[model samples]
Target: LSYVDGFDITRHWGNKSSYHSANDFDMTRHWGHLSPYHPADSFGIQDIGIPSNCEVSQVHILHRHGQRFPTTAFNDGGNTQRFAYKESARWWASGFFDNSDGGSSSTSYDLLVIPEDGTENNTLVAHDSCRNSDDDIIRCFEDTTQGVFTNNYLKTVLARLSNYLDPKFNLTIMDVYAMQTICPYEVAYQGSSDFCRLFTEQEWIDFDYALSLRFYGNRSFGNPTGRVHDIGYVQELLARLQNQYIYVGNISVNSTLDNNPTTFPLGQPFYLDMTHDNIMVGVLSALGLNYFKGSPTGLPYNITHAPNPPENF
Candidate 1:
């Protein structure tokens, strides 16, 4: 009878050109038969089970970050520069010469002189040259580092949760705790690149320096070793919870008319954890509740099936 709801805040930030409100995104109107809330005569538990009596013991909200400026090849350009550099290096090693460098016919140089009108034309050549020769990619790195999507969206959502809790619950103010992934720099910078490759000595040093700059703004460093610390944080919290103690005392009084009049007391406490989408999906999938057709809420008034409970629970 516990009142539990699963929500993905990022899902609410759907394509801006489309629906505007939560009601508008209710699937029934968007995709016809594919909608979870179709027929208009059906009802889901979320709609009909209002005014539930169960007090919320805990809430675990796992959601994705807000809309991101598309990071795939469709948006922030591709790995064309990296691939081109590899190709150029291979061609040069195989005796391809750039005649631009003056030298004896027998004296060979390893450089690919891309033509002005080819695929590697003026624009692409200039971009590659800047990214390779002068580390102009730093500007791209900085642009993403200072971007606003994640931080702003997270703050807004947290504020909304705080406001909702203040009026809806009677628990002590300090009972609620919120936590998020700590090493966002790693998440943001790694992009789609594979990080398993062994780095050269200079490459390793450069990576360390870049990581320092990312975490500490090139001044003071904090936990530059990546996301391993989050595991320790989680373990520490769990240990504290396991070690917590509670006590209760009984009082007795005598009544003149009634011989057996007594009361029993009970005590309970709970914990809540805030996390992200992948963790939720992983858990749901493990519990065999990850399957879905259209929307999460099923059909409209009485049409589609309801969301299934997690099998493990």
Candidate 2:
């Protein structure tokens, strides 16, 4: 049987006045670049070509976490630096600064946009620890990735700050990626962040240029687009995923699914796991998601064919 398209489903079941298909949220454009993890307008059916007599009795699902910044801290990767008041003033005086912020020199400054000090020590610390023992299910898997402040998340923090911050002073974001990701939301939401207040209507037009560079410029280390190309990590996760349902003894066992569902109905009613995009891509690869796999000319180990953020499946 052919799968029902999302648009068709929406037309049939969604409110007629405001129905929107998942296609409306295309994940290939500027905002769509935040795909895979981006919210879907509605869930659609996938064509499996099952026999007419067959019926689906059980469903399994795996999903990535919500919007977040690159795992490697900006400072660690040299992608961002702490805001320096003296340096900014000097740059502006020497004409070395770009007026991405709309405010002119004649405009009196009330609020200052600066970065927190001691950013050098912003290292990737262990979020949790896991032992090697096979008996402990809770301690078997743990996420080691670290996340920095970027993307739509910035808007969330900035919105909160606007309530207490003064409107007189202009704000500037030193982190390019953070600014790029936050730019869209700032334009839509008036009370976004103090940093957003710096951009005038005219400057907002040219702001896309800066964001493009931050997104498409550097290719090494997954710059512009934060992606993981390490094959070792991908392979590791794929191995674990493939073995996730294979039940073995307590020593070195990896299966999570109960072999006998009739005997253990409540054993695995619902399974939820949260992970980073890098690992999620690996799982997708193991599951044989062809579309996610990059072109033959491009290497998967280089993130040419990997799952990006906000992908819903």
Candidate 3:
């Protein structure tokens, strides 16, 4: 956490590279994907200066869940079969997995069994203590019928997690993508883990496009032509949020829980909630924070350019 101003040209003299820069604070939003977290992207204690006269009162916060593999909606195979096909073809051309007798066909991921040595699988192990020799890793890339955590997603995630821990840590996936997204950042600073590093930059961009299709595609109402803001999805999210609280004036107040035993916001000084990015955006839209009847030429929803540094509430 400690850093010097410049490159600290003392690497030969025993100083490690701990340089700091003002650019560290400039934040970029990657929509819960595998993006590095800049120190400046988040608030630091010192950055939230102490008031000279006023005392701190209450605080409320909401944040998106961690970066994860694409959601089940995209992992369902049909949506991502094309990407998998392309990536596998590239791997086949590169002879990346040729060290093993993983079969001759790159498209048949089921037949591809990774070799123990001389292959990148040596660096990849899952949480189940199952090394990469099995078809788990390739299953993620090749299997078109797999569900979110069924085939290889959870195992790959855990194996990647086991790399940094005491090796006995039973890292589990909670049937969600946020945890999947969040865990890799722990080892991201180390710049290791091939499972997390499997995609090229352009590949990631393509992967993002697939994700956009999952969220904003024409499968749902109000999504014809791949509209960015799906009115149906937005309404659904608002209805779900309404069951818990109602937006009153400038803030959201909890709905009366006459029959429920849960405590209200009576004694709590701080409240924190973690949810999907779509829910957060939907909440903002419900509040009419930046309401828009954008024209067809306007920026589409999921495909549009996001605000630089992303706007803060």
Candidate 4:
């Protein structure tokens, strides 16, 4: 990463060979929302623990395949089934969740499948309100960053990784990315992948950087309607938090479920709802949490010593 990507942390963890465990090289850790459950960096407040005077009260887990970051979750490889099995409690997950062995019959009521017929409003799956048009900030970020990424990041990655390949076979940018990406998947399903060893930890982090640019911009707050896409669940969450049914509607909140106590029970000690990882990120913006937010204006993050953000906001 010193000459290849110039990552800041590369100086510290650059070529150190001691940090060699499967845990150290796990690419799933850097997949943003798709990443497995991990602790946020200890930057804000330096301590996130509640006051000692306070006692544990309510718990709401907005799960994807398993536990995610604060107020969000996602689905991943071998870890996917591990979560479902460990929960052992109630399972309120998406019906579409299909592992290698399918789902357990014990958690039948947990299934929530939304048809793409465009009628189900209270769903995090492919929100149409936020994605109805393409001329929004998503397109802007893509148009602005994709080329820069290709010319700068992708080119460097391809050149460095190509050295390991046979000279008879040429490795394109797509080939490099695909090979790097398949690590997480192969590990999740098949248990281990040889591709996992092809890149350094910094390379994985940089590839994760490229992915962060795409997902954070296209699916979450970087887009114009980022929060709006996942507001339904947010509202439902508030209702549960306050032990009251939501009164306002016409957006994503499906009144039928939120209104019904059977579907949306109140005063529960714990709550779990599984959805898409992309929406999990959008939920973060909807809740207005600044933990992962690098910039308020939602401009793409630049990995430079001094980032020259555009003026005239």
Model 3 stretches with alpha carbons more than 4 Å out: 1-56, 69-203, 209-261, 291-296, 300-313
lDDT of 4 by residue, 223-291 (tens): 666566677777788888889976556567777767777777788776656556667777877887765
TM-score of 1: 0.20
Off by over 4 Å in 1: 1-43, 46-54, 71-276, 290-313
* Ranked candidates, highest TM-score first: 4, 2, 3, 1
Q: What is the C-alpha lDDT profile of model 2 across 1-313, one tens digit per residue?
A: 0111222223321333111234452111233223223345544667667779996543433334332223336432333322222333433433322454434532432222222232211101101111221123321121001012232223443454455668864443334335544533332233223333333322332233222222222211212122222232233233444533234322112223223333213323332333333334434443455553334432222121112342222
1 versus 3: better lDDT goes to: 3
**TM-score of every model versus the real structure:** 0.20, 0.32, 0.32, 0.66
**Using alpha carbons, what is the TM-score of model 2?**
0.32
Model 1 deviation from the true structure expressed as Cα RMSD, one decimal place = 31.9
TM-score of 4: 0.66
Count the clashes in each prediction. 12, 10, 7, 3
lDDT of each: 0.26, 0.31, 0.32, 0.55
lDDT by residue (20-71, candidate 1, tens digit) is: 1353332212211111222234334365443578665433222223212222
The lDDT of model 2 is 0.31
- lDDT of candidate 3 vs native? 0.32
